[model samples]
Target: MSHFPMDIIESLRSISRQTGLPIWLVGGTVRDWLLGRPAKDIDLIVPERAFEVGQHIADQLNGTYIPLFETVETARIVLRESKMIIDISNFRQKMLEADLFARDLTINAMALPLNGPFEPAQLIDPTNGHADLSRRQIRAVSKAALQADPVRILRAIRFTAMLGFHLEPQTQQWIAAEANRLIYPAMERITEEFFIILQHDKAHQYVDVMDKLGLVRVLLPECDRLRNIEQNNYHHTDVWAHTRLALAELEAILLSIDDLFPTHGEAVRHVLKQPMASTRCISDMLKFTMLLHDVGKATTQSKDADGIIHFYQHEKVGAHQSRAITKRFRLSNTETKFVQNVIRSHLRPLGLLAERDHLSRRAYHRYFRDTEKDGVVILLHALADISATRGKSNWQTRRQNLIDLIRQMLDYYYQPQPNPPLLNGTDLINAGVPPGAEIGRLLRQLAEEYAAGTITSREEALAFVKQAISPDATTTPHSDI
Candidate 1:
């Protein structure tokens, strides 16, 4: 609601009357208005010269113009006061009726004339979109509509999740008949619609729907290979099924954050909302990473003498295998690195938390020190991974222990050391110490000692450093150092 500019409609109509160019509010704007939902963005269509018209309207309203002049002759305006976006474009097929028929969905084909008074009678419904809206269904404008743009198939899926609408049986059959058309569009276009689906609240459920609709096979063929791959005794389902359940559990964990992590829930939630790439936030990445965490287990499966299964270093192998997937998706360097790190360290939390009774201050320090900002994400994935393992193990006890481990780790992560860092590389070099890895080693050691409450002041830290680098002292720390 904050993004809608309430006073701009008159200005737009005034400009339209003066210029004699009929601008109609089309697509989602009109649909949301008719549905009694607050509009976040606006879409308009003109007879022609959309780029120029869009810029002229922006200038008249003191808004900023974002040129989207492409094959469709589109441009955008960001209202300075409300910060809402308006996308204006030329009619797709040169006439309003043709344009409406060319659209993908009936619900989106309606347009209201901006030049006339606002009224329901002024609405243009070519494909009986109003009837479809009343029925809460998504029906294609025509079969050729999808044949014109296969990417709209993804939009149909997104609409079902976002608007809580169902695709009619005929539309579903059309989608099934040509599901492979999804692969023809540019990857960027496919990703645009794909991410909208992924960002929904029920993404876990709809993603499986996408798989069943035969779209996932065209996008991620590797997923089909995960089917029926068996796992160790700790898992009740096969690899693909467990992966889906893990994704579901991750969403459940996020929803139940207050119960699972009462004190640090909000802070952890805030971190998960950060943007990892242009289209994906940290939460999206977390869900996606869970889907690929055990990809290496298929190649690493082995049976010991006791007939027990083992997947030695599958995390490492999975990490190595994840690059190709990231590259195929054209993920940015930051997102690619994040996915790799999560797969590489997905098994760390349990191993580190297994010794909670004798857990060293150095262990806590080293784990967070090594992971830094990624620790939160890694720990959340660990919980989901273990939560999905509903097999022959002591499930309830392990679940409690994992949750407690997450609480302790998050506490250590949020609670800073009582004292500031005592020594820097410059100070170490000034003290005749070498300027290299040893300085880093000494600083890490000091951080651990500070965590342990053994080193407090600058004087004590300097003496420890002096003793650490001395010829006779046999000083060692955690392996991570």
Candidate 2:
């Protein structure tokens, strides 16, 4: 209790005295407090009437009361001013020890009295949770804990990563034995936990641990298929290994983005920090794309007549596959399209590199236009992918080149357009071009010409459209454009 802020402790004590119900600070809140971490969310277990008590607490504190779980009689009191949340719930079992035993991890199976005077000695650790916490070990309360709730498996891994604790041998065995049950959890739950893992700085370490525990295959079969798939001589390792290294390198680059691209580092950081949908950050989405960027290679692997391995159009194939995967995870439409677009156009930056000298302003415009705000993300992923593939040979030059290219792209994207569309749809319609798909196609072509410095004014655009619509023109009008 001494670990908590005095205001929270006094408020809870006042609420307990008013309600005349014994309240206990339970679960993760207590665990985090003992570990000296800031706990924003406070969980309170009461003997009964959890919702009623929660409402009273909310009213007394002028907070908002929300019924979180009606059937379970759980409610939440949000102290908006303090940015803290108090969750009140009925005990799962009649006795506190029984409730603690029903929890997933031993380290979390502890509680402290909230009504009584603050005292560290009042902690109730029925499963030796204090010892485990001191040892920095993650152990299950019981063998059936994970079997009962498969989501706990992911939670276990998350805690392992978050707390920098190793799972006890017995706990590891239980996770391995119950690994198949991970599929039972809702996709939303799995996705939430997966991205949370990626949000950590050492996400690559946890991902490797998840792969070793056999959870990766269940979650991403496409990635699993790349396990032993060989690549060309340009790559030092298999696809799976290279993918892992790319993720690690991606983290490194993001951390050091300031030094790499000093001109656009702030913009890049802002884009990465921007929220995608509700549950994921742009950086998390980027990491996910990096992991799956080459998944299509497993299916598209081939050898030419000269025995040179080729993964032609793998990015195109991977984009389609990533859509299905993102959909399966029940990600928002925005997130789904973001991941798909990044996968599809990941190779574009490198393509730009190849044609750097000849690439027109229109080409850069079209690249950014197709990729949207995710263009920077794709550029960073490409840098990581190229670095991992090339290994230790002159990677600094290549990396610096990619960073410079990204800086140029960012500058181009942020810079004011040198040529806004010289002609719009209405202008095209007035120019004798019928109002239909052809008008839209002609408008795009005119804009492309404008961007390419081919046409500078409305006269040039009308002339181009007239020539495009003429019967003497040999090339057919591109409706798809």
Candidate 3:
């Protein structure tokens, strides 16, 4: 009642009163309301004739009606230009139980009346959702619900991460049995949930559950390979443990940086604090990249004679695997390329350093060309990835190098593109220079030299080009010529 937007409540009540149909603001909106969190989207339950009610609400509010399952009984109401969603559903006493039962956990099943009398909106304790919510326990409504939709198994992990709740024992068993069914869900759906976990502060807790329930094997079977995969002497944990720790550290780093720079976290932290959510700022494609970033280690891991393990050419191998995975997931071209770029250029820390022998100007250009604005993400991933390695590598030195590289790149990227061809080919042609391959090459060379501060004026550029075309004149000084 506290967190529910008064306007949404009044709108629902107006609809229910006008239609003579009972509607209740149920599900997450109510749960979040009780938790003192902001609830903008609405999910309403109608005892009977939900489709008619849905059509009426959309009409009355001038909203859009979207049939969720191509069924008139289940529809969504979208407020015009507001991005507010009101899911309307027909109440099937058994199916309502089934729907509530099918939800990943019990705490999300509580409901409140929309247009009924002044009495308190009934808690509707059919599944003991209130008790579970009070206990902060995520208990499944029924096993049949998990059978109906196996994706709920994966979603349970997300709820645990977001709410800091523990999965009930029986629900935990259900998840263990059906975790592999996650592969049956759409890749996009799996990736959607992945980000929610990454954004949450307690993301590692749910990831641990995912690992234990065998869901990691189904969604990212590559993770299973990392289990018991020991690292070299410098490491403190195995690959799977390291991966989860890395992700958790990434979240912490993002959080700490936000405290240091609030506006930076504005886009990412919103979904992190939500009970049920998806990523908004980081694209779904990038989430996939994060999910698969370490996958190649499963293939490239090796043990040397000295008992030291090395993942040789992991980045190169990862790049190939990422492309295949992207295609298998039916990703868009831009998304596929983005994932590929992340995987390929993930090992960019040393290259970002100012070491003259290691980093050429051409290499510097290539880094910007590939990473573009995602340089931040790449750098973040590098920091997280290396830290996860559990090696003796000095993070401070690495961090300083990264900071220097970022400052340099930002300085270059933000400035105007080197004064926009101070001497164009037209200028070259007008300077008694014949139009030919030499002219194009000479003009390009002159612009590069001018950009590097070798020449300042058009006269200097013209004089330089003349000297190039007449090197013989260096020996014979002809003032007239």
Candidate 4:
């Protein structure tokens, strides 16, 4: 417990001294301490008056005391000073041992009393959790664990992904048996837990695990439909197999992203590491988006007179279709829009194959302007698709050509071009334009001109806007402060 602030522990010990009600630091707090990991939050169990002691400790630490559950009288103390959280609660059962036994996992069932010095010898491991920790396995405290709360099914896999631990034999059986109950939890909680697993280094392996455990059937039933759908000769496997291959290939590509795009290694890493909506990293979202990229194929699949299969405008169809799933998962609006945009534009890189050796400036302009530099991320996803498709004998040649095109695309995207418009609403309003959508349209037009090399100076921009707004008149640039 030396990892924790001494003052906070002291306050709890003082409370015990005065009230004479036994307080124990239980569950994850004790487990994390044993694992030598720092604690961000601790669970405390007291005989009674959880709110009173929680408020006192909050005041002692200058934190806020928020009452949680009125029946159990659970209260939370958020300490900004140490960036830690302390949750005080009355025992769920009559005693600490019963409360510990009632927990989800054995590793999280350990505890230590706050009345004395912190020592491993003081640990209350009623379930032999210490041995399981040594084994790096997650074992449920009882067979009724999953039945008590179906959400723990997701939590069990989450621990495996987070800690790189395996499930004990019986625990695995319980998970496989109770996997469908995962659909019963609140969608937001389920989404949050799924995002955590996607953040793992090799999430595809766990995706395979989820598939085998039958969780995928309940969580992503659409995938079952994709399994029966076959693909054209450009792909050797059916759509379902290719989808799994895509996820695995994408993970490999991301891990070696620096080597693949050596010159822009750090730039690509920075974009992927950025947090998207709900505070999930862009890298995590990429996996989800990639898996669903071809989902429209389920409905759009067709065959021509030659029996060659085709998925016409699947990108557009997929973007339109994925809305329901995105909404179901409770993704933030910003995240939803991003996923749809990627799905719509995923085929842009391949479409460039028919163009000349060097792409036009306007071609780059439209893609980057629409995506707003997020095209860098789209390029990575496109490369993964190309890598996963190995049906053609000349696949390497096609892949190389696409790689060259991407390098050129990224280079053009990163060039030191001047910031667009050279104008703003203030400048426009100072001139003759009103403060509304018209100003935005004119600015967008000016930005387009700047990108296309049609206008080079503020003087030219003023003339172009004046000519476009009123052909008979000329306007001057804004100068006075």
> All candidates' TM-scores?
0.91, 0.90, 0.78, 0.86
The TM-score of predicted model 4 comes to 0.86
Greater-TM-score candidate between 2 and 3 = 2
Give me the displacement of residue 329 in model 3, in angstroms.
Answer: 3.6
Summarize candidate 4's per-residue lDDT along 1-481 as a digit string, tens digits. 4565556777777877676767888888878888877777878888788888888878877888899999998999998677678999998888788888999999999888888777888888889888899999988888788888887887888888778899888988888888878878899888888888888878888888888888888887766578868888789888877888888888998898778888788888999999887569788888999878998898998899999999999899888877888999999877888889888999887777557365676677767888765688888888888778888898778877877787777777777866654888888877778778999889877876776677888988887777767857665543211
Query: How many steric clashes between backbone atoms does each model show?
Result: 0, 0, 0, 0
Clashing pairs in 4: none
Give a tens-digit lDDT track for model 3, residues 380-478.
Answer: 666666656556666656555565564454444344664666678787777767888978777756755554455777778778877776647453322
Model 4 residue runs over 4 Å out of place are: 1-7, 14-19, 59-62, 354-356, 419-481
State which candidate, 2 or 4, has the greater lDDT: 2
Give per-residue CA lDDT, model 1, range 204-291, as digits (tens). 8888878888887788776667788888788999888998899889989988888899999999999999998877898987877887
Better of 2 and 4 by TM-score: 2
Give the TM-score comparing model 2 with the true structure, all chains together.
Answer: 0.90
Candidate 2's displacement at residue 264, Å, is: 1.7
Give residue 212's error in model 1 in angstroms. Answer: 0.5
Write down the lDDT that model 1 would get: 0.84
User: What C-alpha RMSD separates each model from the true structure?
Assistant: 2.7, 3.3, 6.4, 5.2
